[model samples]
Target chain A: MKSLIDICDLSREEIDSLLDTANDIIAHPEVYSEKCRGKKLATLFFEPSTRTRLSFEAAMYELGGNVLGFSEAQSSSASKGESVADTARVVSCYADIIAMRHPKEGAPLVASMHASVPIINAGDGGHNHPTQTLADLLTIKREKGGFDGLTLGFCGDLKFGRTVHSLIAAMSRYKDIRVVLISPQELKLPSYVKRDILQKNGIPYTQTTDFESVIDSLDILYMTRVQRERFFSEEEYLRLKDSYILTPEKLRRAKSDLCVMHPLPRVNEISTAIDNDPRACYFKQVLYGKYMRMALILMLLGVN
Target chain B: MNIDSIKDGIVIDHIQSGKCMEIYRLLDLEKLDCQIAIIKNALSQKMGRKDIIKIDAAIELDFDLLGYVAPGVTIDIIRGGVLVEKKTPELPEKIVGVICCKNPRCISTTEQELPQVFRLADRERRIYRCFYCESMSK
Candidate 1:
């Protein structure tokens, strides 16, 4: 009856349960492989996302579920001027659950109204990607050993980074978590985030333009690229593009146990040379994404 | 035109003039067989132009539905040609099953089964967020 719509829908206990399920699926793959056998996952990707769509497909396939639906609006019934709700209604007859990615703000939310199946928001126009936050949670729990009492630093485009916003919202529930925000003046965390999630909950957080000065204090470093598209001018983006790239040299200033993370397809933000360092968990983050998704598939299908 | 007052009916007052027809259409008032009278461009001090709708039949109002289309409007119930009760709907705390959050990627939008549930994050400001997506509008 529940869907992974936003990270907030899952409480700390629910998230912990999902994580436990993920761990169990990882440890006992055979037991959960046929969990959703004969069920189908309908992927309604209105926007192009090869990676996320693939992850969902791969997750469903590994769970013995058939995958259907379009990769883009151009290929689907969307070309026939069908509304998101109508598409979802028709698709529900064919699938047990739907994973949707759209460029519009709430297209998936609208579709949910008429759907007969659980709707998973794959991603929405810089709005939300709860599964990504789930993956990040798994990465943090695995890399840092636990969720509580950690100093986390989020650097780069905090303004439009749905990943960053979701992570902050999800982590605010944990104990003794300090957030050190690093971004240019224009691309900083929105006030609502600070007010609604941080201050309202009394989560300890500090903002700074100085990433280099605070690198050593952080236990987890989340790197997001400064999206040029979100900016109005090239000159402004150029000035802020390299403001906080994580290079091999920068890693020297960081603590030995610091884990570096990036939502990949990364540009010049995190240097390729730094991949050799044990602290770089961006690649490992991707693998953890699969495990977490596998865990989600099992949990949602009621097999776990 | 002068007309006799009804014994019981629901009166919608202070509707934005041109929007009354839209609200009527939104409520599908045409389907009703009741004698519904619509007053256009009525005099109002608060709103420069207002419309009024009086349905000359005993009709119960759905306050939750009223909140969606006419949150700013006030409604009065008349009994025996006397104003017996007045109901001014407050905006819903959480809007479910009506209207849409403008966020396309919001799960409520993409999935066919779930009703669009938006939390009225700011009532005075008329901001609603998807309960599933966190998509907001001012």
Candidate 2:
């Protein structure tokens, strides 16, 4: 593929190859240090995302490449009325690859259309985050051994959580996968997702408002931040935020081998006390984020 | 009373009767310099009631698009006061810049320059999904 706009953009074989490459990068970091020695990466973050922007920059730096671009829209030409198409066209001249995070849902797709180089969607609105899905995949492979025959439980704000949407779509391609969606009424997974991706693929899934009831059957529990920004009022956010928190008491009911996952920059959905727990793989997921990005850059640039 | 036939123009026939106004607005028929006639509730053997549009100008017509809106549409080309070509349009595999995706999270909603494209996902259900965000196009 010319660009990575969505998780489905990569085939099952391609996803497997990317995971293999990530494993290689983790194994022999020294051997691949200078792989992109003279190449450059442009991170055009129209939205403010410190974690995703830094992950892309760090990935490029580890490959012996340079990084450039603005972290926010005010600092870039976007504020001066330059379109994403024009910005992508201009940046493609200066960089070998471009990673973009925009508040608009399809801004990266627009950039990909105009850009000569590869355009990776860092995080676009609440639409899709393919790289985060990659990190989640790598972590799942490491913690659960494989994707087959696993019950994954997703908790908290599934409606606006891009990571949850992306991970579920990616995991649907695997064998014997069952998804348990745990969320409040307002935060339930969008019906289009359940209809298009899950039901259309014939993948079995169950939805519930209670996490305790389904905790023991899950092999992986993905916790998500119940963002204050997603709610209409602060009172509503407060009411739902504490409902899905993954506390030690809640963990008692979960499977012993359950791998607790989360796309970080969390806002109280997961208790900090579980940070030391071996089953909490979110921190390792952060490290894997860099490795997966390294593999993504290498693959996109066609470097060894 | 009969609407005068066009000597050199295009004829869009077999549209579902009540949908003529929608097709007229979509095709921007009001802006055309040629003589145009909207024949509504025309008696037909194939269809009980149909709409026919005849334009006295040879403009480029999107047959696939016409088929998408009204699947049973037929296009006829007239030259030298006689019918030269006849066409029955099929539903297009994908429609570009025709219908906007109503999904708020769709990329096309924000990227004003990008053409709103939809691909036929389920033929039996007549379902179309946006090309960018994969949301159903209403």
Candidate 3:
């Protein structure tokens, strides 16, 4: 079974193919309306997630497949202390594929070990959210036309931002990709990520506390929220939550074609006034996320 | 300070000084009923000081744990007071149930039956990352 537990699990060619399929799905949605006919998708969310669960359900429905499974652990057998392996084995009998989200890291990996069908990791604690990286990739492909020779600026909460880590890992394979990491000292990108992904790949990078000074040089500005769920202390979260706020004034020095993005559910990190600024692609990222999910479902089911 | 040579046993040599206790603890040497000797801060020509452990029984050992805790240490096997074989444990590709992942969000933490697994991520740095969460082993 080919389960996407991490972004690195997919090669550059595979990602390109997924992007191609997503583009095709966007161009002609009717052609793939029956791609997954008679198939079933089980959304096994052990944690509360609105966007990811809905996106998976919506993708399956669009592919003419039936969707089942619980929205949270409280509603599922997990509440009764059922193991993830057992749940996966049981769900594999009903669904052709499984999209799982859990509070614990590597929960989906445990599921994939026992699942007869492919397991898509929607999100696993603060470890990995590969599909979100897929969405970011597709959005970047659509905006910049390719992954090479781009200066990408990642701002805020890089420590716990799984999307940023995964994307950097994915983008490191491309040529001439320069990274500008903008965050406070407290939430800087993890050293392992810098050493393993960036430095090992010979990708030039700059780490800075000043966001605006480097904003003008970036092609893509990925703004992330300071996630409270990732922090152990509320005091620390409060101290770093308002570190970087993307206002219209902040973009004055940035390029007109700069693509500003966020993973969504923004809590004042991105100003509402900048949503109309044509440069803000965060909402579009959500839409692109759905199309990429649809493409992923088709590929995983071998219906594409 | 002379320790008698065992008739049939294993001698672990050249452990970095002061690391024998950790290896002894991790290897659960205290659980064994056989005679065990730990010589700490022994003078060495190669190393300024080293530690050696001698077990008076040819017992099975967890080489992965040994490799992780004390790399480059030599293991000498003896049978009938004659040298049988000498082995050096290499950094294992994967280690299971050797060390628990400290990441609170790792699945191995909540799953009681799950085996704690860590993979060697960097050889030069001797870094082991949790297989479940990829957090660096401290």
Candidate 4:
């Protein structure tokens, strides 16, 4: 009864197994359709994350499962003073599995404690989003063919991207993964991830404000937006905004095979011109996210 | 001065002062259906500042509230009007819906609809983090 609350919750073998299952599903979509014919996926999104919510719904629908639950807390029973425990107890009666996104940090964990079905954290506050981490892993695996010995570069908003934190957690579990953190000092990766995940795993990583100089060395350039609002002042955002943009001119210097990935709804950190480069995998990342989620919905429902 | 003993209860001790209200709001202690004694600014030799809350009918401390208020505070379980056990909440292994993670850019903070999830990664040193945005506050 393992719940995908965090990336590290799944071991390397388990991740590989999930990837393999996703690959099989991708290879033979028709055979896997209707795998969870009667099951229901409850997407209890307390926050309105249209992208993630749609992704989850699409995954469930494609799996031949029904989708239930609310996209916002204000419209749900939770707004009327129902504790997460009560909501979980009630939702479990209707759904085979639950994927919850709450603005609060520990909402999913609390729900998991009381849920009868396996609980998936769609996204919790600024905390971990295991599924996005899952999507990133699948995209990386499909692009690079494996998870070992690649120089993974994390660019922009390293300080607040839960995706970055979760990815570091997942990738740190693999061997010989060198990390290049390209961000302004204001948006540098938190000490916890750098210390707990990277340093503890003994993964070699270097930090710099410059991304171009190191572009050629990276096998993957992960782009995240550093919003001006995240900073104490616009001056700081302005100072660092250009410090990390992935322009086509910049991509010209990157490894010909380097994968350019962004967890989408991207701001201008990435230029549209670079989207045509075969290395730009962000759009494909979205499709893979859906397919991987389709794999997840089937897997968690025990139909895979 | 001798303190009045609770008949059968839990005593929250070493709470950093000025946080009784946060606990009050957290537990809604005012609406409690049980007898309770709350003493703020109580004398202490070890703690320069301390507060105590004694529940007359055995009550479990809302540990998340405790962790958020003061992570290292000790709690005593009392029975027969005597201290039968003393314990401290280990750092919360996972924090959810506790403190508003201080990161404003955090979806949890901005959404007005999500719980602030944090995991207690280092208990002894009192580290908790927002589960979504990954903001750390000690």
Candidate 5:
């Protein structure tokens, strides 16, 4: 059975195919209104995530399918000490496909091993979030027309940002892509990511603490929040919390067509005043995320 | 100090100096009832200093654990006190239950029943990563 536990699990061709399907759905939503008719999607979220759970539920509803399962561990058998494998086995009997979110890394992988149906990892702690990467890819494709030869600037909390790691891994497969990592010394990209994905792929990249210094050369500025939950020390989190804030003034030297993006639930990292900028595509990215989820569900269910 | 040669046993040679005890502990040599000898910091022309282990029985060994703990070590199978076959353990592609992932966020850390798994991520650098979280095996 096919499952998406990591972004690297999908080949470049598969990602392109998914993007094509998403674009088609956007162009003609009526044609795919009932693509998953009579199917049931089980959303097993062990952690609390309003946005991702809603996106999955909304995707299933729009596909003429029913959504079931718990929103948190307290509401499910997990609180009673049921293993993820057991939960997946039981849920597989009812749902045609499953979207899982857990606070523990690789929980989806364990579920995928036991579940009879396909498993989609909505988010797994600070680990792989393949669906989010898919959303980001679709947004980049729509904005820049393609990934080739585009310079991407990743700002803030690169060390623990699973989305940034997954996107960099996905984009490394394309041609002539460069990266500009902008963050404080404490939050720079991990060395393994730099060595394995960027350096191994021969993609030229530069690291800097000053966001404005490299903002002009970027085609896409991916701003990420400095999540306090990922830090061990409150003092350290407070020290690095306001390291990089994207304001309208910072974009003065940037290109006219530069795409500014943030995986939502922003925490003052992005100024509200910049929302009106024509290049700000974060909200559109959210909508595209739903469409991509719809496409993914159809693909996994073999309806597409 | 002289250790007697085994009659029908196995000889593990060329272990990196100072790593024999780790290999011994991980291999659970203390659980074995058969006679075993560990020669540590022995002079070697190839490795400058090396360790060797002699087992007085032909019991099966966990080659994966051996390969992971002491790569490039040689194993000799003896029959009638004569060497019958010489084997070299290579870095295993996957290791299960040999080492636990220390990453607290890893699923293996929370799921106690799950087998601790690791895969060789970089062969040249001799680096292994937890199969679940991809954190480097320290």
Candidate 6:
């Protein structure tokens, strides 16, 4: 069975097909209302996620499928010490497809290994989240028209932001794509990613602490929150927190067509005032997430 | 003093000096009941110094792991005090349960039952990354 354990699990052709399906769903949502009418979706979220879990639930419901499974590990048999493989084996008997979000990296992968049905990784620790990458790709496609020759800038915590890492991994596969990594020195992109994804693919990227100097050259500016929880000291967090904040003043220096994006439940990294800007596509990103997820759910279930 | 040759077993020769213990531990040579000889820092004509391990009972070695740990080591199979086969193992494309991924967020750390699998990410650099999390192993 096909499962999305990582962004690269889907080829470029598959990604485009998913995007095309998303676009079709956007144009005619009612046509897909009864697509998976008798299907069942199991959402096994071991971690507490509001947006991602809800997104999957919403996508499944929109596809005329019912959703089941626990939102937290404590509420499930996982608290009783059921293994992921066992859980997957049991859950596969109940659901047509499974979307799992776990705090442990590769928990979904273990489930995928044993699951009789297709397993979609909702979120797996700081590792890959292929669905979010799908949403990001759809947003990029809609906002920028195409993936080619786009200069993408990623700001804030690149090291811990799974979204940033996944996006970089996805975009590096495209043509003429350059990345500008904007982060404080404390939250720089991991060297392994730079080596494995960017350098290996020969994608040109520039690292900068200053976001304003390079904002104008970017076609897409992906912003990520730098959590205070990752900091050892309040002082260090405060010192570096505002360095990548997207203020109105900062947006003034960015390109007029620059698409500003954030994986939501954002903190102070993106100023609320920028929501009114014509270039702010983050809200649209949330809606695009739903459509893309619907596309993903359909594809995973082999429902066309 | 000369180390005696094995009669019916395997002799691992030309291991880079100081890499024998790691290879031995990885291969779990301690579990073997057969006579084992470890000659460390032995003088070699080709290499200035080398390590050799001679096992006096025929035992199957994980050649993939041997190639990964010390690529150029020579392995000779002995039967009735005659060298039956001589070969150098090549690096395997994938390695399982050898190097543990140290990434704290990696799933193998939590799942415990998952195999610690690694794939050769860069052959030229001899770099392997955790197959699940893609974290590079040093």
Best by lDDT: 3
**Alpha-carbon local distance difference test for all models:** 0.83, 0.89, 0.93, 0.81, 0.92, 0.90
Where is model 2 more than 4 Å wrong at Cα? A231-239, B1-11, B28-36, B42-50, B55-60, B71-88, B102-112
- Chain A TM-score, structure 5: 0.99
TM-score of model number 4, chain B: 0.78
The fnat of each candidate, in order, is 0.54, 0.62, 0.75, 0.08, 0.67, 0.71
Compose the digit string of candidate 3's lDDT tens values, residues A81-189.
Answer: 8898899999999999999999999999999999999999999999999999999999999988998999999999999999999999999989999999999999999
Question: For residues A104-131, could you state the per-residue lDDT of candidate 6 as single tens digits?
Answer: 8778888999999999999888787888
Ordering by DockQ: 3, 5, 6, 2, 1, 4
TM-score of chain B of each: 0.84, 0.84, 0.85, 0.78, 0.87, 0.89
Worst 10 residues of 4 chain A by lDDT: A225-234
By DockQ, the best candidate is 3
Off by over 4 Å in 6: A229-239, B6-9, B28-35, B45-47, B56-60, B78-85
Error of 6 at A252 (Å): 1.7
Q: Looking at model 2 chain A, which ten-residue stretch has the lowest summed lDDT? A: A226-235
**Candidate 4, position A237, lDDT:** 74
Per-model DockQ against the true two-chain complex: 0.30, 0.55, 0.73, 0.12, 0.72, 0.69
Candidate with the greatest TM-score versus the true structure: 5
Candidate 3 residues B1-138, lDDT tens each?
899999999999999999999999888899999999999999999999999999999877876668888987999999999989999988888988778899989998887598999999998888999998888887
The parts of candidate 5 lying over 4 Å away from their true place are B16-35, B40-50, B58-60
Give the candidate order by descending TM-score: 5, 3, 6, 2, 1, 4
Cα error of candidate 4 at position A297, Å: 1.8
Interface C-alpha RMSD after superposing true interface residues, each candidate, one decimal: 5.0, 1.8, 0.9, 5.5, 1.1, 1.4
The docking category that best describes candidate 5 is medium
lDDT, model 1, position B54: 82
Give lDDT tens digits, candidate 2, residues A71-136: 999999989888888999999999999999987777888899899999999988777899999999
